[model samples]
Structures are given as structure tokens and as C-alpha cells.
Target: MAIAGASAQSQTYVLDKGWEFSQAGSNEWMSARVPGTVHQDLLDHGRLPDPFYGMNELKVQWVEKEDWLYRTVFTVTADQLKSDAAWLTFEGLDTYADVYLNGSLLLKADNMFVGHKLAVKDVLREGENRLMIRFRSPVEETAPQWDTDGFNYPADNDHSEKRMSVYTRKAPYSYGWDWGIRLATSGIWRPVKLTFCNGAAIDDFFVRQQEVTEQVAKVDNQLEINNVISTPKEAQVKVVYAYGEQADTLTRTVVLQPGKNSLSMPAWIEKPHLWMPNGWGDPVLYTFTATVSVDGKEVASREEAIGLRSIRVVMEDDKDGKSFYFEVNGKPMFAKGSNYIPGDALLPNMTGERYARLFEDIRAANMNMVRVWGGGIYEDDRFYEEADRNGILVWQDFIFACTTYPHDPTFLKRVSEEAVYNMRRLRNHASLAMWCGNNEIYEGMRYWGWKDKYSPVVWKEMTEGYDVLFRQLLPELVAANDPGRFYMHGSPYEANWGRPESWKIADSHNWGTWYGQKPFESLDTEIPRFMSEYGFQAFPEMKTIRMFASPEDYELESPVMNAHQKASIGNFLIKKTMALYYKVPEKFEDLIYAGLILQGQGMRHGIEAHRRHRPYCMGSLPWQLNDSWPVVSWSSIDYYGNWKAMHYQIRRAFAPVLVD
Candidate 1:
């Protein structure tokens, strides 16, 4: 094998232009956009209706069941094609996809959460090259596996009749969530790029904070360098950190051999300004640049902004049971915020402006934390970047939610890769406070009466598989990859709503007010150590309601309105729950207003109850902060970015100084 010297450096070309997509067997190819979905492309080409509008979602169900093909022609210059290595990378491939370069198969991708990188040095040409990705239907690809499993795993949130979400590694909410539409999108959902590199390239650059104090902060600037050449080469590594007018530099020389080389350069910053949560202090940040040079000339380099902060989740044994709270800079901090779902059903639409506005809302509300729910995709880098900048903390959950999954070796291997990739990608964020395994799998298995539904042997097998994945595999990965970070097997771990003792320990998801049909006062009565989930649903503002409903569809139970309501008993529950506290309004707009008032009141009671308890109750995050689509769901903010009455009430409740 031949290798290019350091003189070649590295260059990247984005394959985002001149792309087209069509059904797999169809001859028509319309203009397409990379980092977008098939549904989005169809709408762009005027071939599909708006799915979020009244009754249009049902008409677009066929899109997720068919195979789609995407192709793009990109040219490589003669000078660029002479590099030692060329690699093609996809940031995200929705579910099952097969990649081809020119006419040869390049890679088969099965998980949407994991990025794929393929070595394309052998297939390169000096001129134009054809790249095609054939995406199989996630539903069709996983249907057979569900059939062969011989048992129906509990996945109640999957609204499709096939119930095949458990077998696929895509976003669980894409199949269907109570608040989101059932539009399983498939395409190159993220960016695609081709890179030409020389003998070495920077694989990963992690600035791990070893310790943080007012005096000094110690960090290890770890760099993973991949050297493609057969022989060893001497290279100069320089790392520089800059904050305000002050800067620090570290320089070293190392010999890089073939394959991967791990290098860590330990350094310290004196009199560091700590990154603090929303209410504590300013969230100071520093920028760093790492450059690799051969013969004192820069060859490859990486630069990023980072924050130096010490954060940990404190779970200490108390006389009552156990305490669950977050400690930042050695002081216990109460988490005050709401749970976050995917802001849009189609994720690409969550633009930077949207993120900026959302964080502004969070900061204005005096929120210090946000829980990224399990059913959604790992959000884009911009999401965390905004969190880091706003001085907000993030509670991240692995993308397994409200269901049991298969534990076959192949499935576990894919999961392991997904875990490692995400951990490495997100571990450097200052806002990352904890890693939770899943949302409510343990509670569903134990308290949802699975024990009585299946035979003892089958039940044993199911529970064992749960143990292996959550208790063993996930925690072990967190230990190995992201050491010192807080790891919880699942949210509300060892805490079941049925068990009174559960409320005295760890975290809790108190759904008694909604799912249990209890009154809003139950939030005050049945308090837990950490209130992780509790919220009531509200109709969006009338302006948002008009987005999907017309004058004729103004009635609560109208077909168009019901089409927007995905919860089975959503309308009935709202009406019933509202009649108990407030006067049932007659007009459609009044009804929406009344629902928002009731939701706001209910959340206010919960938030006040949690905050009043102080050290006993450490966190209070409602079921959701935003909606996936415009629907009557448990969200403070509507899909159209309208703040419901509940959001304003929440803003008052989460104030640093509460009157209640």
C-alpha cells in the first residue's frame, strides 16, 4: 500500500448539491436535498400534501412502506484524487440503507443513530463519481424479525399495526408517539461528506476536565490520531486554549505508527472561571485548537469551544431512603425545568434559529435543566451547543423508550456501537449532567402486569434480557467510555408508582394525576425524592389551532380535530378533567382557553409542591416542554412555537425566588 506524505494535508467536499431521489423502482427522479427526508423532498417537489394538516397524515402513510433511492454526482479534481486515502462519511442514515460508489457496494447501514464512514481510496476517480444510497423501508425490513421473534414485546407507543418498532434501531417516535404523527421518514437525514487525507488525520479531540476549582482547573487534551502509513513518522502536536485575553499553550513531539495512536497532553489553567448553571453565575467558555505538524508545517488540525465545569448526580443514602440531586461545583443544585421531546416530527426542520429561540425561552423562564426524552433522536450538535452557551444543564437518555427490546447478539452489537458513538460525540459538552439508560422500561415490566401476562419461563427470559441490556451492558459502556459521569440504569430507577417505598427513594415519574385519573392535588400529596415526570395536556392557542383546523372543524370531536389528537382518550380526558375544576366552555375557542388554564394550574401545583420540599425533592420536570407536531398533548409550547398558558405559568413557578 502507498501512503501520501504530510504535504498532501486533507480536504473535505460536501456531497450536498446536485442530488435527486425517487422511489426505488420508479424512473422519475426529482430534485432532492441532502440532510433531509423523503417526505420533505416530496413536499418540496409538490408531490405530497402537508402531513401536519388535517387528515393529511393518513394519506402519507404509504411513504414509509416503500423503498427509496438517492443519488448524487460529485466530481473529484485530479490533484485531490492523488491523496493516499479518501473516505465517504454519512452523519446519519435513517434506519436500513445500502451505499454504493460508482457501481460497487460500499457499505450496509442498519442503525440510524450511528454514523457510517467508508474508505473509498480504491474506488476514487479523477472525474465525476456516482454515489447512490438505497434505503429500505424500516417497517418492511423489521416486520420479518418481529414475526420470527415468536412473541409480542410490549411497545404500546408504536401505533402501527405491525408493532415492528422494537426490532428497528431508528427513532422510536418516528413510528408513532402519542403526540407525533406516524410518518416514518427515510433518506440521508444528515450531512454527507467525502474527505481526502494524507498519512494521518485527527479522529477525535476530547478535552476531559479532570478537576475544576476556583484556584485551578486540570484537563487532559486527548487526541486520537489515525496514521494510515505502514511506517512510523515523527509529528509535532500543539494544543492551545484561549479564554478572554488569557491563553495557554502546550507542545509535544510524538512518533505515530500505522493504525490508531492515542495521545494525552495534561495541562492546567490557573484561576479558572467555572461554567455555572442558569441561576448560579455566567457560563464561561474557552476555545481550544489542536494542530498536528510535520517538519513544523501544519498538516491536520481541529478546533472547538469547550467549558470547564465539574458536574455530578448525587445519589446518597439517607434515613428516608436515597437522595437524587445534581451537584455542580461541589454544591447541591435543584433541577428546575421541563422534559424535552423532539421539537419537530421532521428533525431537519429544527433550524438554528429555532434552537436559539427555544433556549431564549428556557433562560427567560429561569430554568437550569432540560431532560432529553428517550424516544427522540440524539439532537444535533447545535442543540447541545446552545445548552452549553445558555448555562443550562442537560439530562440525556439513551434512545430506548417505553418498550422492551431484543437482546440477540447482532442487536446488542449494533446497540454497543450506537452507545460508543454517541458517548464519544457528546461527552465533551458542559451541559451534560447525567446519562440515563431508558425512560420507563423497568416500571413497565414490573408494575404493568407483565408477570401475569406471560408464562414464568418466558417472563424470566424477558426480564433477564432487560437486566443484560440496561443493568449490565449500558452501565459498563458508560464506565469504560465516559468514566466519572453519572450513569443511571433507567430514569426512576428502583422507583415504581405502585410501591409506596419507591416514592421515598431516587427519582419518580408521578403519572397519578393523568394516567391514574387522580386529581391535580395528587401531585402535592404523592411527592417523590425527584419529580422527573408529571404534566397535564393542553390545547394549543387558537392561532395554532387554526393552522390545522378550519371553521367547520372547530368542534372538539370533529374528524379534523380528532385527527390531530393521537392519544386514544385525549379529548375525552381533557373534557372530563376540565369539568372537575372549571366551567366547561361552550365555544371552541373558549374550550381551548379553558384547557390551557387547567393545564397551567395543574403544572403550577406540581411545580410548587416539588420546590416547596426543597432538599427532599430535588428535581421537577414536566412530561414535556415542546410538541413534535401541533396536537393536544402534554406540552407547554406548541409545535408552531406558541407558548401556551402553561408555559407562562411555568415561567413564574420556576423563578429563582418562588412566592408559593
Candidate 2:
């Protein structure tokens, strides 16, 4: 929400409306919406059928393969053009994008996970300015040239057999998921703004509570500023720290450099109040005003809230092989939650209210933690903000998933930049617990027969990328930037990975039910220390299923049903899973209801089983929390935020107290 701004010194104008979008190599443009994807824009103009509808997503397979272009015209007043620090900021551009201002090339963007800006003061005209953005095809752009013979282990992860997601810094889910369409979309997927700045502007507002305790805590603040003026200027860095009624101010005077300067300052609080995650105590937060003033005139002001809590990881090898858990304020916590993927594939369409509702449901269910899965987009600020307010700890993952990646120097450089940019932004949130390198890439490589099948050359390249990206690049960035959080190489990782299930020292994703098609009893046989991902699939409620399928064709194995259930053997898998516990119902609606309850029963039993092994199994975050579309997936909550029977079961399983 606070990326770019404008005033008399700097003024920001919204450029989110009144745009034209056209397929690349086209002569005509159609009315488009900014902060939207090409798929959404086409849907708005009625050229494309609803992808969420049954049998429609399969029909619209060409959307992800072609390129797209967006053009718009904005006006700038003569009075506003007096300042020299004018810029155009794109908060997000999905995958590859090229921008031109009045036919003059301005910027080329690669990563959809990050944002970029260009100084437009020189090229922008006074009366009217024409802006154009051309988005390249993600598939053609991200195709890897490396040898692919032995890397064919996880064969089901292909985005319609392209298998190009690993090479790009975009949302991996866009390529494909069991529940998602392969709409590897293009266009501006976030807010677009044009800002005009005169002299100085604040770039990054970073605030963190460091070395926190009950007696004293240090509040660290950093303000990165860019001074456009050619001369030196004196500025005041002031922080009004407030906790409850009492307030204090710490101010400093410094001479700013001509271009870029960072001012770091710290303040100590006496009798500090520590913040706590859910079920521990009230999550108390202190507010601070980060401001930059020149000669008593406030140029920039940012309000930030911080919770003073010291988080420690107590991981050690004990008689139980090893132990892993998070200690908040010196008290051990058993994390209770699920994995969070993108709420929707069209991210910009997900509003603050929708984001809040998801977390609200989590809070109501007594959930205290959520692992932002590695395959999805780095959830926007609204998601983390809601987590902070709800006292839900976040287990963040770097954007890598079930496949091995190449260790190309250029690709590594792009990844490093993305890491630096995103980590710096995520570090300030009080709810952030740990940085996981990936979801299941490491475990997949070990368990999916990659070690046996991989050629020596492919193995070498894969290991090089793993070491450099996770061990070297990410850890170094975290150490230099945010040392307060712990870094796990990956979930299900053990120091001695030779024995996958023996070293109960880390998190585990037991897919016995879905992938292995094992019975629910398998969850109890070899219990994980921390079950990060284990789930069963179920179709959504009839209200949602009917949106994609017609009532006349409402059979279980109907073409419409198969179209919605994208996972290989998904419908049959659910039928087999249901047959294990209850009689497979005759009617479609009865079958769906039975499947929902069966899935919930399985998950509820797993949660109780994990909790029964209290000290050994410290946490249980199931496979998924919500779905990206109206599909038969492993989400308790469907795309419309409707709670299935599993959502209610989670409320009981994750309750603060349990009774027989």
C-alpha cells in the first residue's frame, strides 16, 4: 500500500483506469482495466468465456501462450511539471514486460514477484502523456535450454507439458496446479501510479523491534531517502513512539547527500510489553511515526506498528531423534494452522475485505499459524497485515516448488534481487516466524526417485542451484537484512536426510491419502514431528459445482466433473477414499456431502493424532486452507469463501482446549 507517493514536492496520481489492451501483433485495442490481467480484461469485454465455468477453462487454452499490450494516455499539468523527480511506478508486472513512454523505451521488467519504477520527468510531456506496456509470453520467454533427460521425475507438475515454470520468477501456480487453470497471464496485475517529486523522498520505511524483553526493548528504524536536488539539505528524522497512553519522541538532525542516503536510529523502551501469538496472550503492539522533515516542514510521514517479542527456535537432537518448535517470548508454541496458497489466480481482483475474511475464518477456527506456500505469489501486504492483527504466525517460503532449477548465473542474479527486495519488505511484520526455502522441492527430489534417475550432469546443476540459492544467496541476504528470523532450508528437511522418516527433527508433508491413496490409518502409523502438509480432496458445495456444470449433466464422472477436477485421478481418488470409511452414496449431492465429511473426518483425526503425541508432534498445518477456483481440490474452504464440513472440523481440532 505504501510503495510510491506524490506531493507538492511529490504527488501521486492513480493510473488504474481508462486503458486499452490488445493481443500482441494486433492493430486494434479494446478497453482494459489496470491492476488486472489480460484474461480478466477479455472477460470484462465479453470476448472470453468465464474460465471458472465448467468446460470453459479447457476452451481458453490460448490465453497463456500469446503476448498482450496495454496502452493509456494521462495528462500532467504545467504547474506540476516544475519538479524534476517525476516517475511511473508499476507495483507488479506479470513475468516479462517492456514499457515505452511516447515511443521512448523506459523500462523492461522480468519478475512478477517484484515491482519497478522509472524516472519519467525527462520524457513525460506537459499536456498529455502516452504510456504503453508490452507483455511477452511467459512460456516462450522462460523455456530452459538445459538437458532435460534425467530431470523427468515429477512428471505431473507440467503446466500443460511446458515445464517452464522453474526458469521464471513468477507465481508457479500460474503455470498450473491441481486446482488451477494454466492461465500464465500477462498485464499489470497491481496498482499503477505516477508520482512527481521535487527534492527529497522516502523510499523504504523499515521498523523492527530488536532484542526485545519484558524489561527493555530496542526499536530500530531505517529511512532510505533519495535527494534529487543538487545541493545539500538538512532533514529531521523523528519517531513518535507510543504505547497505550505514554508517548516519547526521538529526533535526529542529519545532512542529506545529493542522491541516496539511509539514516538508521534506535530507541530503547523501559518496561516493555511483549507481543504474543494467539493462545499465548494479548498481541500488544506499539505504534511509531516515521517522518522526514526539512526546516520543520514534514515532507514524508509513515505510521508503523511493531510488536516487541523475541522468537527463538529450539531445535536439538534428543532421545526422540530430534526436536523442532518455535519459542515466542521464551514459551514453546505448537503451531496450529494450514498451508496458504493464492486466494485467487487473478490476484488484483482479491480485495482487502476478501483477504480479511480468510484470516477472520482462521482466527475463528483458533488457527495461529499459516505457511505461505512456495508455489504461490508472495502474498500481498494485506494478507500479512491481517496476520499481524489476528496474531497468526506466518511460515514464509521462497518461490520454489516441486522441481529442480538451473543454476545459471543470470537466473541466480534475478533470484537474488527478488530475495533482497521481498525479504526487506517482509522482515518488518511482527507475525513473521521463519523463512522456509521451499515447500517440497527438497523432499520431492529425495523421495520422487530423482536421485536414482538423474544424470550426473543434471544432478550437479541442480545441487549447485540448491546450495547457492538456499544456502548461500538467501541465508546471506537474511543475515545481512533480517537476522531475527530463523531459516529452514526446506520443510521436511533433516540434518541427516538419509533417513527421511527417522530424523523427526523437522517438518513433514505426509501425502499418504492423496498421492499414495493410502487409508486414513496411515496418518497414525508413521506420524510426523510436525505435519506441515497432509490433506484429502473434496468437491465444493452444490451451489459452486453448478456454476461450472449443468444440472442435466450432473453425474460424478461427467465431462463437466472431469473438467473441473484437474488433478490426475482426482475424482476416482476421492471415490476410493470415501469407500474406505463409508458406503459411496448413490446420488451426486449425497456423494459430495459424504466426501466433504469424510475428508474432514480424516483431517480431524490427523490433527487430534498429532496433538495426542503432544511434545513429539509439535504442529499440524494441513495441506491447504482455501482454493484458487471453484474446483475439486484439497481445500477446506472453497473459492467463494464457503466453509465445507472440514472448516467446521478444524474449529474443533484447533480449539484451545479439548475434552472427551
Candidate 3:
């Protein structure tokens, strides 16, 4: 049987046309476009018959009970198949998918954040092939029960009443919210492609460079291979790597004959030039090319570029508490960067250019790290490449957001696939630093039940179920796939009874002021490794705010057009601090500067208070560094992409001169 195809060489294909879709349970047919949302299409045709009614207009209730099907036809030639092996791939699907090829079920996957691929060798014909997929959106009925209360009803209620299972209740705004949009059912939200490759393909690869010295550096390459043929065939694996202008190169070779083979190859580089961040020198990258050949014919090949560096997060025990610090290349360094949300709520809409610009901005700001918030999708490959090239470290979080997730078999399977897929895809990048199991899920448990303070049921569910997934499942998955990196159970929450000690470092998310506490307070106290979130929300610059608000909007005391305005003023103080760095010193000096000065002083005092109490506190990544769609956030900048005075204050605070 011919496994490879000529068309396989071109993995990119237009999947935008010929998609037939409908609401999950409705028999009504609707014409839709791939890589688009159903809501947008409905609006364009004025099919959205209702206005200002929450549940009526955005009724995705069908998705809770049934599946939405998408069908399309594609073709592959015999010659194309003979040239390269191919697999059908989906960049993303809403929540769950059951894929079919020529009416035969091929694969089922549940994670919306991770891509899925299925081997199409036996399913493909000489020409046309029918492709159909049934997607089931997340179970709407599974939302927390307490979320049904009108917008802010629970504000006056007890915390115990609010601690309801999200899976059992309706999502926030199911009754109605200001967004004026209804919930949407399933559709092909991202892109779909057919990727072709040769026999004994390169399934995945991870490179970790360690043991660096003046004369030589030790490198380890782990490659995963899928042998497609029934008869075992011997193959040779070769690796070539080079760094910098002096054209010296390093090479290593291994042999394999197998079904699924995990090969580890070690190589030595002579007089290796290390990759450093912007200020240290050029952010140099070492390019690596790996080729798998059968009888000298290249069967598979992959290329990756990585920086050689060793990083360690040291926690020192002192009388007061523990102090945390980061060491890169054996030298202590301060982590200065922003917390990143998804570039777009709609994952498919993000582009390579957008990723490049984000990295460029981080570089321009003279920052070294970016914390990928848990609320967003695991970014595409392009995002990691930009970070790798720019020498920016990534603090990665698994995708569980603000609340407790359902503990179902399907959920477990989905998270497992996500762990495997993302670990494989990004394992090669040197920029990836740490993997956090989830966001504030554990800590937020305390705030779940109103008045009751703590519910034994909710606590048991969170500790036993969610904790097991992270401590046992996720960590084991990463170790099997990519063993070099570290894993944290959940951000800011130490793993207790159910968690393993292997989960290194204690992290905390402090947002006392913004959520409910007083506006300002002294940070003269220390806590577990401080990773402050939900602080400072500066108004956008005059120019950026003009795009959304009037000039009078700039007045902090005036009634703002939106809640985002209030949030921005909160952030404006920090922006004022950043403005002082401008070359023209007098540019930011004025009576109006008083507010800006106060903002800077507060931020400095907060950061210094944590730093001075060292050993117990390691680093502080403020609530957020950027925005996705420009809602109310504690970001120092506004939606229009203008820096506020706080940006400069952050730069100085995170500067090596201070923390390091």
C-alpha cells in the first residue's frame, strides 16, 4: 500500500468552503463558512430575530443535549498518496469531535484547545473522500448553579450560596449581561488541514541543552517516531546543529527499527556561544536539523532552533520565611515581563504577524518573561518561535480558568490529550520555562460558597478530583513526554494532602485590593512566592482612549462611560510612573503629575516591600501586561496598545538593578 502522497508535502489546504452546519438539535440547515463563528454568520443574514433578550437570542441550549455536524468533501490523488503519507488534522474544534472519513469513524477527541490528527492511510481513495465531523460544545447545563443569579446578586449574599457546581448551573449572563450576545453552539471554529509525510515519520522531538562550560556543551535530543509500515524497516536518524558565525557544526546519528520508537541522542558542541537576552548580547539561536532516512532516502525531517541555557528557581529559607529568585546560565536574574492572555478570544483568528508584534513589544520593553494565563488557549507554534528568537521565557499555564471544571471521563481524556499534544508541540523550544497545572482554581474554592465560608463538599471535590488530575495525571504525562521541564500544581496554591512533593516552588496570587479590600495598603509583609494579580488598571493614553471615549473621559473624577474607564484610571497611576522615563524629563512634570507620582510611589513601595522581605518572596508578575479585547483589566496599558506611566515603573522595578 502506498502510504505517502504528493499532496502530503503541501500540508496547507483551503478548508473554508463547502461546510454544512446547523444548531445541535435543530433540523434546520444553515450554510456556514469554515474558520468562522455561527453567531457572526447569523448576524450577517439578520437571522438573529431577537434583541436584548439573553437566552432567546443566544440559545445554544441544543449543544448541551446534542452534537453539531459539519460535512465536506475533499480529494487526494493516487500519485499524491504514493509520494507521501498523510493525516487529516484539525487546528481546533469547539469542545469534542467524532471524525469520519468516507462514512467510517476514524477518531474522537474532546479538547478544544489542542489540535488533533488521524492517520488517513486506509481511509483515503484515489480521488474524492467524504469528511464529516460531529462536534459537541461544552455542556451548558454543567455550569455552576450559583451563576444563575442576576449579574451581581450574590454581591450581597453569603459566599456559601455562591459555591455551587458550575457543571450543574447556568453560565454567567445566561439570564442576561451587558454583552448583548447569546451563547453559541458548536462549529468548526479554527482551521482544518491534511498533512502528508513519509514512512517512519517524525512524530515529535524535544531538545534540552545542559552541562554548559567554556569548552563544550552537552545536548540531549528526544525524538518520537511513528513507523507506519507492517514490516519493520531499519532507519538512520541524523542530527545537525550549529550556532553563530563561526561555521563549526555538531552531528549525531542513531538507528531504529520499530513501531513507535523513542530515541535519545547526545551531541557535543565545541566552544559553544551561549544564547543571551537582548541586553546581554544578541539573542542568538542555534539551529538544529534532524533527518530520518531509510536506505539513504530521507523519509522524514524536522528543523528547530534553540538557545542553550540552564535556569533554576532558588528558594532560600530564612527566619522570616522563604525568598525566591531565578538563576539563568548560573547567574541570578530578575524576571521582568507581562502576563499574557490569549491574543483573541477566538483562537482561529490569531495570526503569525500578531504574535510577532507581541514579542517585539516585549523585547522593546526590555523584558525577559511572559506568563501565559490559564484562561487562554495554548498559543500556536508561531508564538513560541517569536519568544525563542527574542529570548523571552514563557510561564505556561494549563487551560482551566476561573472556576472548578467537571470531573468526567471525557474531561480527563481531553486534558490528557492536551497535555500530550502541547508537550510534544512546544517541547523543543528553549523559551518554555515552567508548566502550571491550572490558574486560580484551588484558591478560588475559598470564594465559591457564599456566607458558609467553606463547604466540605466543594473542598473535597476540588482537593480530591482536581488535585489528582494535576498531581498524578498531568505531571506523569509531562514526564513521559517532556521530562526536562518543571510542573506546578496550580498557580499560587501549594499542593497539600493529595499532591506530590515533586511539585516544586510555592506560588501565590494576591489581589486583595481590587476584588474587595481597600484601595491601598502597605506591602511591608511577606507571603509565599508573590505573583500579584489583579492590580493597577491605567486608562489608555489620550490617543487610544479617544478611539473609544471623549476628552472629558480623561478626568478621573468624572462619571466614566464604562466600567473599563474606572479600571483604566486605577491603572493610570502606574502609567504615570512609566512616563517619567521619557528622554525629556520635564515632559511628564506638572500639577496633574501628582496623581501619576502617587501611582509610581505605591507600585514601588509594594514591589520593594516584597523584595526586601526576600527569600520568602521570589517574584511578582502583576495581574496582567496586555489585553485581549480591552475589557476592564489591571493592565498598565489600554486596549489601543498605548503604554501608560506604570509601564516605566514596572521596567525599573523588574530591572536587574533592583531585584537581582
Best of the candidates, lDDT: 1
lDDT of 2 by residue, 283-400 (tens): 8788878777777777766777777788887677788777888888877898899989899978888999999999999988889999999889788988988888888999999888
TM-score of 1: 0.97
C-alpha TM-score for every candidate: 0.97, 0.95, 0.78
| lDDT agreement with native, every candidate | 0.88, 0.81, 0.60
RMSD each, Å:
2.6, 2.4, 7.1
Comparing 1 with 2 on TM-score, the higher-scoring candidate is: 1
Model 3 regions lying over 4 Å from their true place: 1-36, 40-71, 140-186, 213-215, 245-258, 406-409, 446-458, 494-506, 516-521, 524-529, 532-534, 541-605, 608-617, 655-660
How would you order the candidates by TM-score, starting with the best? 1, 2, 3
Best by TM-score: 1
Model 1 agreement with the true structure over 1-660: per-residue lDDT tens digits: 112223338877777888999898887999998889999999998889999889999899999889999998888888877887788889999979999998899989999999988899889787889989999999899888878866777788886666898888899898888888888999898888888887688899999889998899999999999886778989989899999899989999999988799999999899898899999999998998898887666778888788888997889899989999999998999899989998888888889999999999888888999999999988898999999999999999999998878888999999999999999999999999989999999988878876787788778878888899999999999998888899998987878765778998899998887777778887777889999998788889899988988899999999998888877878888888999998899999899999999999899889999999989999999888999888989999899888888889889999889887
Better of 2 and 3 by TM-score: 2
- Candidate 1 least-lDDT 10 residues: 1-10
Poorest 10 consecutive residues by lDDT, candidate 2: 146-155
